[model samples]
Target chain A: MGVGTGNTVLKVDGVTKTFGGLRALDDLNLTIEEGTVHAIIGPNGAGKSTMLNVCIGQLKPDTGTVTFDGEVITGKQPFEINQAGVSRVFQTPAIFEDLSVLQNVMIPAIAHRDGKFKLNPFSILEKQDDIEGRAVEILERLRLTELMDKHAGSMSRGNKRRLELAMCLVQQPRLLLLDEPTAGMSRHDTNRTIDILKQIKEGGMTKVIIEHDMHVVFSVADRISVLARGHIIAEGTPDEIKGNPVVQEAYLGGSVE
Target chain B: MKKFFANQWLVMLVFSAVILTMPIWLSPIGAGYPDLLQKFMIFGIFAIGFNILFGLTGYLSFGHAAFLGVGSYAAVWSFKLLTMNVLPAIIFAIIVAGLFSVVIGYISLRRSGIYFSILTLAFAQMSYNLAYSVLTPVTNGETGLQLERADPRIIDSLFVEPTEGLPLTNFFSLSLSGYEGFYFCAAFLIIGFFISLRIFRSPFGLKLRAIKSNQTRMQYTGFSTKPYLLSAFVISGMYAGLAGGLMAATDPLAGAERMQWTASGEVVLMTILGGVGTLIGPLLGVGIIKYFENIFSAINENVLMAAYSGLPEGLQHFLVTVSSPFVGEGWHLTLGLMFMLVVIFLPGGIMEGFDRIKRLLMKPFSRNKDAVESAEEGH
Candidate 1:
């Protein structure tokens, strides 16, 4: 599939992040267009997670700039970045484990709808039909309506990941970041997750994902960027990445020649 | 819909009924019974407020007693300078405590988890020391603030009759004494309890739980966790202040020991023993601990020997001496043991222990229902 839709949502220019003597990200340059899935693949300690963190405001880069929707967000707080409509899901299912699934989803929904935290006891939460309706609709989309009343902690790993996605999706973010969304899943679960992600992309949400599994990267990614030692060595379509000799040697650890 | 009512008004009604009638039931036992019940309700309010911060947020502050002391001192000062009208004194006390919490919380929440708890503890110790020495004019130099009988009543102070030697109310010869004082304190406890209940059900309450679980996730979900945490802190502090104010209202005395770190620790024990995160658990905890302090402390060798006297002299002396430390002033030893057992065996508290018994009793009746639900949920 073709990228470069002329609607770049995230533009990272000459970004570098360093920790003490080590360079986690070195002059990383990338542009993720709107309504597409952009995947980054590399070995361990490749700074894939760091890049996502910087974009989502969890970490700040040492050098270079990040522009999202024509606004500089290089050093903003994570909550500020989130309020600007960028959201992320962690590798592990980070949810309020004790709260019910419905309550979990309602948290971000309440923050989004109310603009500030409302603590009035007299205000009936059950009367908020709009919020409830939207939450139910999102839960239905993820087939989690039946599990809404259940504690989020007890859900299986696959369902937990799905629930995390639902939480991120409920915010209706402009750009979504997924950090190893299918990291520990079986092959079948991985494929099923790819299908869910494909649906998310088809619904016109821009995505930046870091994946170690090349099968998942190739299955849904509109464009692929191969990173080695914290630098993007190649950026191309799936076929170009699959055939690139340098990428094969650097990433696949061998060459067919 | 019926289940919803159970979740709402049923709890309120039970709390109200217990607060209303507890002193009456206890007063017939002795002259000091109402006073003991009043103390229980006052501390119950304190723990319920404290649970919002510690139990809900999982921030174990070891200095919360400072707010209690602040409230008591503020209320006593109001009686000293302005008037003995409990309403304005309570309002002033709570506002001062809320403002104090804002400053402390802003600084303490900067470091989370263990750091936050330690920081709060340090602040509380600082307050205790300052009250004992540095802030002599304000805190009265450990002598504690006492209500002056001849103090001017500038603003509708509690009308007192010299004959009764206590505050009195007009019409029907009613007075704010004996069971009436206990009832007044009980009403405040009911209000504090319901307010806590509302806070537990609100969306803000859910976010507080989320912050407790994973604050980073909450931050990414567009919540500045600081504001929520700060608000919870202020609300909890105000609740403690209200309890302190009511304590002074009932007794008209304030002491520096009220703000001691051990006092703060006592409330923590109360919350954990009753069931941290359970709405009614803190009340149960405060009631149990207070009962132990009042009733168990009254149990002496004479009472014990009187009951088990015919069981030979050696056995009687052995039992009374062995249990002596747990009775009559060392009752906190028993409380400490109770807290340890509850924490170790039932980390969920007395509520969890009660729940275990309930599940055991219901096992045979709901076997198929639980089996079906557990299978579907997949653990």
Candidate 2:
């Protein structure tokens, strides 16, 4: 409820999505500010993913308008939405597994700068040094510089998730959407991820994260929205969300104290 | 350009040397004849193009031969109306086949995996039936579309009248028959191989491999995979078309059977047997299969007897009896056995077999080098 303070970069208004007999998303309204970490926490089947999918244009809403940077992105193609500077990391690690770590990051970097499609049949070799330099810089920042040549698929699940984030971040997206970014990670890896995300936050890009871990949500989120039965039930800062009776009853199960 | 040649020039040089000197080396193996050599180059191009789609993109097209047949028909029509020049025939075939691929690729690429393959198969079968029956006016049905002495040659009026002998397809004054025909096809094959090498290392090629790895991931990565796949399909189809046109130019006939599903399967077999994704693997597969088709099938009883004459009387008889099923009229049986062995022992195909052999050969040399280095360090 009016939690976002800065200029709104993404606005989802009256969005409803239904799959056959199931109403996955119902009259969902969300606003993500230009430079903040907004976390969406919900129970199973609470439509966190559905909202992310709608924003990324993976699933068209039954009735609503989703706008990004003043442009309606409700029915646009996934690539078109991505071209509009909205990037998503899936729940599971969705990366070009067969490609090396460098290539995995380079692909998005190329797509980011070159637009959707370029013939580029002859310039790969000439462009390799520059691309690889950029890729190496990203890998260094992620502390994955040593594994740059390793296949993305062969890496650990936690590292794959990191690589996926590196791929998304290399695009320098205006709006980043991450679905369970730290799912299945060890505590150490989760902390490392928190640190990386903290660095990313300092870079001043708006991020909408769907998270199940309360630790991650409380640690990183500037604003937290609690969802139950496909609607936002509570929205506030971390302290407010932790103390809110409605959020505790709906998601936290009881009072944290 | 310098970087392009850094990794590929050696391969290009070796390929050129082997293809250009085929007559000298193949004579000892009895595959030196022009017709067999020409078939080798034509099928080599076909398999190479097929690899661009099936091998790189991982979209197995079951009806690729339709493009080949379309190309042949286009070339034949060019011959009928235009001059006997092979240039126009080859060019027209490529254009027609490219157009045909665009239609088929647009429809079939809407689905993927097995469903995509089935769609292509259905389209190819439909084209085959139409060519055999309804489109007989163009294809000439079972007898096939053949060059006729009475047909108009509009481009060059030098030989308009009916002649007793058949006119050969030519490039200027030189005829496209005998060694010249083999050389012509070989030239195209080499050029195709170089183009394939470029594609394999290109940025577009990386996108195709990405699609093969994960289509969902590629789509979300801001790539419209449909256009990339369609481009690959059309490019591959044109490769098939170029091969078909070369076939017509060499022999002056386009048959409905060229569009048969078996012909499509043959190119797939060639690509898989040599190695699915390697640059020269498809061509190597083509050479092996064509060699068996020509030389293996040509080994009559007399040749078998001569081959075994140096052995003991009992052993010679036994050897000939045992090998008879694998040679001459039974070459297909040999091919089947070879395919099974390759599939079982070398799933990566003949290139994998070659790689294994190379590694085996290098093992001892590497060990010896390491030992020598250690001894020098001790001193």
> Candidate 1: where is the Cα deviation over 4 Å?
A1-5, A116-122, A253-257, B1-6, B24-32, B149-152, B156-174, B309-322, B371-379
Count clashes in each candidate, considering only residues at least 3 apart in sequence or on different chains: 0, 0
* Cα error of candidate 2 at position A77, Å: 0.9
Candidate with maximal DockQ: 1
Clashes, model 1: 0
Write one digit per residue (lDDT tens) for candidate 2, span B152-220: 878756654545776778988889999999999999999999888888887788888888988887777
Mark the 10 consecutive residues where model 1 chain A has the least summed lDDT: A115-124
What's model 1's lDDT at A193?
85
After aligning candidate 1 to the native by TM-score, how far in Å is the CA of B164 from where it should be?
12
* RMSD list, candidates in order: 3.2, 3.5
lDDT of 2 at B135: 98
True contacts kept of each: 0.59, 0.64
